[model samples]
Target: MEGLYIEPTETSPKVHFDPEAFSFEISGESRPEDVRKFYKPVLDWFEQYSNYLYWLTEKYAEGEKKLVQFHFVFEYFNSSSAKYIMDVIAKLGDIQKASPNAKIQILWHYDEPDEDMKEAGEEFETITNIPFKYIINPD
Candidate 1:
């Protein structure tokens, strides 16, 4: 199945989800004027991806496990964006729950001295019960 990619804007983030490469990332500031409209497609892509993952698991029961990396790098985001961000993570959590053979790694990248971002990642880790690898970026 094909993946999803969206260019970033001043008040939005860049989203790149490559299924074949098993790499996904959402980066940049997010405060889109219409939060729901901006995030709806992203959420939809994950639903489709979930279905695709299901097919792969059913078809390749004996195949090797798949390792998928999801990176969340945000410089800033508003509360509305945060809600959709959590929704995205929830979708991922759902994927993880449904597919045991697929290893989903969540990587949270934050700039140096940004304790809020780090703490946000930690909160998500706790809420979703999904492990996250925190990467500190130089300011």
Candidate 2:
């Protein structure tokens, strides 16, 4: 599959989901007035990607986990966006559970000056079934 790429807007983040590379990334700020409308395509892409990987793992690559590496680098986001983020992670968890040779690693990025962002990542880790890596970036 090609991938879903969305340019960053003032109230939303940039999304890049590459199914071929098995990598996905969302960065920038997210606080869309209508969160559902903004994130529906993203959630849909995740679902399709999950199904594709599930098929690939079953038919082609057997014994290979770690099917995806997802990166989340948000400079800022509203409470509503937080809820959507959790849903995205949950979708990934579901994908992992459904595919026997499926694994996902989430990397949460935050700059040194943003302790709140760092804390947000830490808090999300506690609630998610997927493994996460907290990255302290100076950017």
Candidate 3:
């Protein structure tokens, strides 16, 4: 399945999802005027990928596990963006639950000295049981 890659804009974040590597990242601020339009494709891509992965695993019948790693780093996101973020996390959680044998990591990166960002990461971590890695990126 093809992955979705969106370039970052002044009012949005960069989205990189590579099914080959099973790695994904969304970083930067996300407060686009049309939040639904901005996030619909992302949500759709995740659903498609999840289904593809499941099908591939079933067809291969391999004992080896497939893992997906997601990284989220946002400087500032509006309320609309926040809901999308939650939706993304929920989808990831569902995937993880379905594939108990697989490993999924959700890393939250924040700028060093940005207390608000750090706290936001913590809050997200609390809401979801998905394993989270809080990273402090240095300038």
The window of 10 residues in a row where model 3 has the poorest summed lDDT is: 53-62
RMSD of each: 1.7, 1.7, 2.1
In the range 44-118, model 1's lDDT, one tens digit per residue, is 999899878877765556766788889999999998888888888988999988887788899999988999999
The lDDT of model 3 is 0.81
Candidate 2 lDDT over residue span 1-139, tens digit each: 7699999999999998888776689999999999999999989888887778888777646575654678999999999999899888888888878777766778999998899998888778778856788888764
Ranking by lDDT: 1, 2, 3
Name the better of 1 and 3 by lDDT: 1
lDDT of 3 at 125: 70
Q: Against the correct fold, how does model 3 do in TM-score?
A: 0.88
lDDT of each: 0.89, 0.85, 0.81
Cα lDDT, model 3, residue 22: 75
- Candidate 2 stretches with Cα past 4 Å from truth are 60-63
Better of 2 and 3 by TM-score: 2
User: In model 1, which regions exceed 4 Å deviation?
Assistant: 59-63
